[model samples]
Target: MSAFLMENKKLLLDGSVIACVEQRDGEWEDTFICMGENMWLWNRTFTVTDARESWDDFPMEFILQGEVAFYMIPGVNYNGNFWGEGKEPKGLLDDGIPWRFAGHRSGVRAGMLAQTKEAAVGIFAAQENPMGCSMEMERAEKKGFCMRLHFPEQEGPRVYCARDSYEAGKYMETTCFCKKNLVFSAWIVVREPQKQHDYAAFLDKAWEVCREEGSVRLLTDEQVWELGMDFAKNRLYFEEDGFAGFCMGLTWKDKGWEQKRDYLEIGWVGQNASLAVSLLYEYAIFGEKEALRRGLSVLDVWCGRAALPNGLFRCRFDQIRKWGGRIDNDEERNDAANLYSAVTELLEAYHLLAELGIERKLYRKTALAICSFVTQHQLESGKMAKAWFNDGRISDAEGTVGCYLAEALCFGWKECKSREFLNAARAGFSYYYKEFEKYGYTTAGALDTCCVDKESAIPLLRCALELFEITGEREYLEAAKQVSSYLASWQYHYNVQYGGHTLLGQMGYRTRGGTSVSVQHHHIDCYGLEFYEAWKKLAKYTGKEIWRERAEALWENALQNISDGTLVIKGQKRPRGSQDEGILQTRWHTKRGEYFGVSEWLVAWNTAFRLKILRKDFLARKREKSKEEKRIS
Candidate 1:
């Protein structure tokens, strides 16, 4: 038999010190002498004879100790019991005898005669509680050594410490401590080495296969252009035609495949819209006269004129142009008016273009048409809705309609300097608040009254924040805060089976009468993280620190589950099964959840907005710091 020992004080794992030991001589025995501060000790002792002769039947023994409880790995089979509540020996292994253990363990194997120095173990420590302990190992080996330890604070304030040493056939002792109790986890992974293959040659063959498969004809020109722009933005290779189209349209049949597939699928459309708008803005703002003119021509084709009579412009072809069965008794009219509010964004784009002195006749005509339609539709309550189909009468004002009206009115107020438009905008904002005040600034029901009790509280909250920004009204700010508070109260907390807060724990599900159904019962369209970001901004702007903190926590939790650069949608509530129909199945059962596809777009937009607000905050902080430095000087 052989024995070895190696120690380095500087090498740490998650913030905890780790020491590895190997038994070489006859069966070796060791008892944990002491437990250190913020430390966890795990021992895996295997017989050398069995390991060498019958490698498959290697008899291994493991002992683990921590400040509080010992959590067994998912597949390791062992029995343990806790002796005391505080400073107690926990786990069946703590019963003063070796606990029976059996499992097909596969991981790093240490040779009995080999003594190699390895990095120290580290762990994440709790902020307030400081715990320390030590473990003593008895073996047939000799000599003890120590190394350096370092703990670096991360965004989550998690830390790690490690040490290494090299000695054979010796007893080992390790001591570790931290300012707080550390909660850290690590896993052992096992995988077979891959066989040699010619990746370059494989790719060349794949290209031939792709061409033969007729994959070149799959993507449209717009898609190809969007692909190029995205590649340019990321500094990735710009593939023209076949290469770009194939990469953007690939799909698979499994969960992993679904994730990659949705990215390519959604990216095809989203990237196009983003690239088109960005190009137009860039040209309008910074391009030369000729460049601006070229950009404008492209924008005109990409952002086609609305087919509906309502003066709204269609930014993309995918947006439903006509909500059929609507219009006054006159001939069938185009449906672009449904998205009248989106016209503000287009106008903003045009304004940027105008700044570059790129004058276009259509720009003025489109802008004026939108303004006139908004003016004509203003109702006495300061609310406006285009006439409903099959009925010439104006529809009742509510829900998303209020959001649209408020946005459009705000735009009109900006351009026309008309009190009527501003008043109408204010009234629409007020109407929404009044209707859903019971829900605490949340929208009470659908704008079109399609659903009975489902409230679009998120959109309403968003609109309220925007209104507050435009008007600087304290009431709007207060409404936003209340809505944010309502949302926080609904966050999921603990496991439902574990008696934890239900709503905020697993998923954010739609509720009626305080009862939430399974996620499978509802459409996943409501899933969005932007509302949290908006709340964070509202909190910072209004000096509501608590709201900001809560928003931060929710954001962190959501971000943790992102896999393959995509957010996973877990059960917000238990899935209700397949009863819920009409919704796209692709959007459901998505590994990242159905919302994964659109989440990037929403996250990007929200982040852009938040960054603008944060920039202001940053500047204020810098100014204050400078003033303080001057005073000190």
Candidate 2:
């Protein structure tokens, strides 16, 4: 034990040692060790050898500063023979680990037990021993025994008391005291590392490190070409050809019951519908019939005219449905809005299908049904309120809803060339423009309020830009510029750590004062990278190089700070007034350096859009550069 103490002096110097001992037949045995530091105790165990052959000594050492003393008590043995003789002595034996009764007035009592020697530690907090000393020992005998020591004050004499006993094995409990408060970090020593990464190939040959270590399931004709597979066999197709239903995203490999439940719950149909529309457009350009067919089927599902009679559109079935298949009123309205966007996407799919010369009456009927529903729901003001909410009224206005409406209206205008559809799109754009003008690019309402910054600002900016592109309206372009300018002003210029390059621009009076500068609310819901990308695109389209430069810098900073492929956004700073409260602050770190899922939906969409835009722009630049090079030559 002394040698072990000498060996682990560094760890011991940082904390006090707590020892638990058991005595049977006048022989003492050490059970566990706990190290106390700060205000928390960490549990550890060590092996000790008896100094005397007689085995009567219990020797433990703890370094102490200022006045300190030790207290002890003899173990009360509860042998089965003594129980028959009398209850008092047997009662003492029945309680497994001893207890300390001294600081009762201060309202402090604690218990410790070792479930097994192999386990690291055991701890229990109590105002008083619940089972009394005797019953505690009986319980310990059934399982294992435990011991607890209490040191109320380090400034005075230290006292230890034995209260009860239980079944015995190796376990430890620790306590620490400091002037302010105790900080705790658990040190766990497992037999094997919890996580492992492969680096052997990189070590051997750095160039070979780029090789992927996972399986690839190509779901596109282009992917087939890339993989050198037969085009016919590799062509992407829906699971049910000619049947309309949403495509599933990534599937879990484990196929566990919980994963299955989650799969059914959200459905993620809206995003899938968007993916399908994009894929269909790609298929038309690439002349891939299988991809085109699959995309058309998905569009049919989005339009709510699926092969299944009662199948809803891309409405996120589970979110809308409550118990007994009753739909939540608010969710139903949101679902309706989602379906509206899906229907608009279906219009695009129809155009692609027509271009591909795939004639199916299903597409026409689906399109007509969608138009009828949309027309029926239009208000006198040329905009439609969300449906299926309380009293079937749409009162609360949100940015995303307006964005979806604008998108749907644009689709309608292009498809039918209707004046009413154009007006509807204009009205949706008006809502966002007016709101942004009034709020000055800051999020309106309280921090706790729904449809906060991410929900409102980004969508509003997106719709404004789209409106400008479709209508060629200078007013819409100016409005988009205003919103973009406001968004850029709140880019969190000084601290890259706080809020991750974007601030929660809107705040209520109550929360504004208390809001932590560096802390990000999980509910803010905006994608920093997406905002940057959107601004960058707008800058390119408008020939505004400054906007492009600013957005590029923000994007680079965000990527540098908060991204790894598995997107975790930790709070970069402690909350206001938390410095003295003794809490650990948050940090941004991820396993994948270049990619992070900070906002999965936004990031994915933004990345796809940026890649498309950049590819086209790159080719144009390359052509211009080649022409110049030829002239020079």
Instruction: Pick the TM-score winner.
Output: 2
Q: Looking at model 2, report the run of 10 residues with the lowest lDDT sum.
A: 507-516
lDDT of 2: 0.34
Relative to the true structure, how large is the alpha-carbon lDDT of every model?
0.32, 0.34
Estimate TM-scores for all models: 0.41, 0.43
Query: Model 2, 30: alpha-carbon shift in Å?
Result: 64
Worst 10-residue stretch by lDDT in candidate 1?
A: 104-113
TM-score of 1: 0.41
Model 1: residues >4 Å from true position, as ranges?
Answer: 1-275, 279-298, 302-304, 307-310, 313-341, 360-368, 382-401, 438-455, 466-472, 489-529, 550-633
Per-residue alpha-carbon lDDT of candidate 2 for residues 227-328, written as tens digits (9 for 90 to 100): 211211122122442244332222213331011121211112224455456555546444567756665655554444221222233254333223223533
Clashes of 1: 77
Number of the top lDDT candidate: 2
Candidate 2 regions exceeding 4 Å error are 1-270, 285-290, 304-314, 317-331, 335-337, 360-400, 441-449, 469-472, 489-520, 523-537, 550-633
